[model samples]
Target: MKPASKSPSLKCLFLVAALAVWPLPAALAQPQGESFSGYLQTVAAKARREGISETAITRTLSGLTPNQRVIELDSAQPGSQGGPPPMAPYIARHVGPSIVSRGRGRHAELSGVIRKVEARYGVPGPVLLAIWGHETNYGSYVGDFDLARSLATLAWEGRRRDLFEGELIALLKMVDRGVPSYKLKGSWAGAFGYPQFLPSVYLRLAVDGDGDGHADIFSSPSDTLASIANYFRDAGWRQGQPWGVRASVPSGFNVGAYSTRLTAPRCERVHERHSRWKSVSEWRALGVAPMAPIGGDVLASLFQPDGPGTPAYLLTGNYRVILQYNCSNYYALSVGLLADEIAR
Candidate 1:
């Protein structure tokens, strides 16, 4: 799910186009000891050890070569490991009227299916729709890179060897179980299917949502929504709770006084910008109020993405579940805000 950004942090088409213009052959351009064949051999051995049959390993990995574009995109990822960027533009672009309108239309078309998923997973249909819309524009473009090849190439590149290597082994297992290689298409990083689920994630959490014997997230909207709801369920999304709501913060309120002090083990910088958890009652005391009133004691956090001069938000833990989907404040905020508009 990390590869395909809600905002397309790196466009696959552009990366491919860039590679097409390069003068050198991709395989010969490799550095010492990281040849594509060697990578495949290593991954194939690992897969075999993990119980994937040797036949499947050979069939899946044979003739596979490195995808230079994956390395290029992975290395040059913008704003990665950088500070939290201003959310104003990201929110404006991602949660604006265009996306919201399309989301609502899709919502109506899939209302019944969405309700079933929500009932089972305790995740809102609009939230699922927002994720689906953001991930691949409601499955308009689920990417075209072969997952097995992409993971194999990235693992071979050795920059983030452990992560991609694991994914490669997982893909091999999926192949051994009869998942065709051709159906596994996604971003250069191997985040495939409608929700852009990585191979690891798909293996652990993917469900047969449409009850059609398989969870075909690539083309089936029902399976896609169900799979998304399953993801949120596994991520600990709270049922019957709002993800977040725009809020009014009183002037002269020292917003920084409420900022989080602890460093998160992961996405630390992204978590830093968030304020400590405060009940709605505490916020009400500070003259902070959300657009909707569930209660005054609901545990929540404050986020002034554009700072005090602009509107702020009171986000609940369910918002964190959305964050688990992408870990980007921009991505999570947009998905939550878009869900609101979609439901509205």
Candidate 2:
């Protein structure tokens, strides 16, 4: 039985060849240029089976056409370019004085409602304001693309068909829930509302902040705050902990030695920049001192964003929560710093 055993190299080559010829699933086998008309019919059938109403489905999906602009925007996401720009410049621009000032003003303006949201959800008010400020400039704008059309276009584009198709279905459900179709406008990628939430997120987490019996995140600041806080809380934000702290590392400390071996299941690139988790006391023993107070027992990861001799931070679990909102080091850091500035 062992007479015809293959060499290891030959086996490896055979495996590679097999993988190269492996059959894709039927769903993926469909051509990228598959007719949008057929795709819509399939999606509409699925929606009907899922109990979405006829009026809702017709209102949103009937005669919907793919948006070329949405396709352009999705294809042009920042990650498609070369490696990300330097983090310091990114931080400078995003967390600059203007956002800080606006965030502080919004903090004061929304203090009472922010307090109520924080009391219920345990997320900090300034953090909420920072997110609001960053997402839509404190409700100055919330994009203008029709969400139904955008979702349908992205779905028909077939690059991320499953995701956009599901989102399209969720949009139909939102319509069924009495949300008017005309109000469904947002980013080219389909996030809408003051909090820039996708349809599924609005269904799951959006809350009525002012007890108006409607979670009108589009125009109501109170609903926006509550909805955002609910998102943070669901993402596991901890109370009474700073997202991170400015830290100073010792001379000749080998940050490379501390690079994490563990891989994240999602947002792997964003997670790669973080050093392995260590207790604050352990980092202190290694001469990594926090410029501000943090509990010695708290577990934190070192992030030398610009490398040694530059600004470093010891980030906590709350920082990870911020990353959950938007999976970028630059974005999370900006939000945390902006929040601190607003609170200060």
Q: Each model's TM-score, in the order given?
A: 0.89, 0.89
Candidate 1 lDDT, tens digit per residue, 19-130? 3333435545555465566556667556656777655565666656667777788778875565557888888888878888889999999888988888898888989999
What are the per-residue Cα lDDT tens digits for candidate 2 across 189-284? Answer: 999988899998998899899987999999999999999999999999989889999999987888889999999999999998899999999999
Q: How accurate is candidate 2 locally (lDDT)?
A: 0.84
**How far is 43's C-alpha from truth in model 2 (Å)?**
0.8
The RMSD (Cα, Å) of candidate 1 is 8.2
lDDT of 1: 0.79
Worst 10 residues of 1 by lDDT: 1-10
Off by over 4 Å in 2: 1-31, 79-82
Clashes per candidate, residues 3 or more apart or on different chains: 2, 0
